[model samples]
Target: MGMAAVIYMILSFYISNKRLRYYYRFVSLLAAYGLIMSGTRGAMIVPLGGVAMFILLNKNTRYIVGGAICLLFIYVFFAQTHILDSNRQIHRMRTAFHPEKDASYLVRKANQKRLAEYMVHKPFGEGVGLAGMEGRRFSRRFTTDIPTDSHYVNIWVQFGIVGLCLHIAILLFVIGYSAYLIMFRIQNRELKGMLIAMNCGLWGIMLSAYGNNFFWQYPTGYIVYIFQTFLVLGKSYDKELAEQTKLEPI
Candidate 1:
């Protein structure tokens, strides 16, 4: 849901098709409202990181500097004034940046420590379904009752350190290649902006993976794979369009 907003917001900013900009901007605001109401700490990073990347990549130093100043002002203003004093949702959103104030964060850290100790003996982990809730459901024999709060940790437990490295490498490669396309291969402003937004969104998801399993969970995972493929293919489409423009008899 938050990812949807991030995409719409990026489109609203990048798209020169004025006919569609207003609709996308409206949708982006609505999605952003929903994201704030939901109060998912990890998901919040999607918008923050994505927007920052979008602005920075625009190559307009004034906008980038102004955006940073605006963010700082907003943060300071909200923290100083308890405007949402009675709002549970806003309070929860505020706690996201303060991990020490979050009980769930403390518990997650404890569980991670336990998992680390457990992994000391079993280098390749107890195997699939042995480190998470899956283990409790399918193989009670290997279940150690430790919670797998992070997707990266889950991969480490199920497939070992090697698997974790490979997973991270793949994500990094996608981000790096997309950046290359945006910087060198892509000439179309709209296409480049879309790819930049995708790259930022992916980076946010990767960062959030450390705190939650949203990256591999359900529809989000499906969307991630789709966006990844779309960005890669977008570069080729840009080249074809350029060649067509050249060949056209104007």
Candidate 2:
């Protein structure tokens, strides 16, 4: 799926004369559906959030309103049809805030706590792949099976606090730099929209990382790098545009 999205993005970039924007939108929507079908809640939100960002950033009031209504209707219909249980959604939402008291949430907290304690002494982490080994070992010791799913926690377990901090710093830098470019460098409406969409997608990954180890996992990890590379390329594009603009006669 990640590879497909990257290919779609590259195609969108190269297809300059066609309605590439629409193509990109459709591809992103398809990716979102794939994430949903995967049953991974964390990955599922990226496309929805990306669309919302696209609407918001483009100032497309009609589409924004329509998307909101559609989302609300879907939620209501799912709840009414019992395709999705309102109670579970509510419980999970509440658990996010009161994680210590929620069973699944508590397990995540416990793992985070244990990992943090271990990192305090080793600071650099046990090394990559160590977290998975530790998780398996711990599960055996406790005679219970619960695997770690958090990118932040996994990084800490694998590379220690330092690696986690470095990873977070890179994410923050990408978001901050992208915002700067959009605000100060980009003037073309179409280009601005693309940058905003890309930023929103990155934001979705950032949000999802809190709950899933997608940052370093197969397929998703490569996708994250591709997204980051896109941002870097955007920066370079913006710089060229700036230079061109400066050289143009006033």
Candidate 3:
């Protein structure tokens, strides 16, 4: 789920030839399938978010318009329709739109409320690993007894409001910086496309994290860190490639 956009973004952007592009297109579609099958509601939206960013950042107005129209149709037809009415995975994802009707959502909400009341006394939190699964594994604490479903909630419980603010600040900075690079600095189409995709992918993960503790979870966490590195170093990669291109004619 976390890696879906990473794979699709990289494959979709590094198109140097028709055959390669065709291959990427095929694999990217497959990644989309993997997202749907993963059954993680929040993760499934990452690809579409990445695609939206790709189109919006594209230099071509025609592509932007066409892509927007295509998205509208998909939302109206598939998301709003009962085409996959019988598919449990699809049904679960649809629950995202109606949290009031979602059992899991209600449970998470109740858990969040309980945690909030508990936090009124401990402003600095109970400290990391003292709550949630880590807390249970290591020892018992007041927080350990409480259930937290969201990653953000986990952070809040462990680090308190201060930690949560700092965490959010860091994320906003990365996302903002990435957008700045794509819109103003990056000249290479491939790099720009990949960065856009990564930005959207990160957004998906963050938004979904409200329901699932994914930031520190396996695969998703690893993929996110790697993509962050890729995004931050993208400018360096561009410079190095440019130098290589200049030397190629020598």
Error of 1 at 118 (Å): 0.6
Listed per candidate, the RMSD to the true structure in angstroms reads 2.2, 6.1, 2.4
* Two-way TM-score contest, 1 vs 2, winner: 1
Better of 1 and 2 by lDDT: 1
Candidate 1 yields a Cα-based lDDT of 0.76
lDDT scores for all predictions? 0.76, 0.61, 0.73
State the lDDT of candidate 3 residue by residue for 1-250, as single tens digits.
4446345645565557778777766776677777778787766555556557657556777767876886687577555777776889777767665667778878878878888888987777778787676579877877888778778999999999888889988887887788778788887777676777777777767777777776887877887788788888878887887887789965
**Model 2: per-residue Cα lDDT over 1-250, one tens digit each:** 4234433443454345578756875795586456545555445345445545444444456656875776566456543454434565533433333345557666777777765555688778765566654466444432123356677777776677788789899888987787677666676555565676567667766776787766766867776777777765676776677788899999
Q: Candidate 3 — which residues are off by over 4 angstroms?
A: 2-14
How well does candidate 3 match the true structure in TM-score terms?
Answer: 0.87
Worst 10 residues of 1 by lDDT: 138-147
Runs in model 2 lying further than 4 Å from the true structure? 1-22, 48-104, 134-146, 239-250
The lDDT of model 2 is 0.61
Task: State the lDDT at 78 in candidate 1.
Answer: 48
Writing each residue's lDDT as its tens digit, candidate 1 over 10-75 gives: 777679989799898898889889988877877877777666666666676765786577667656
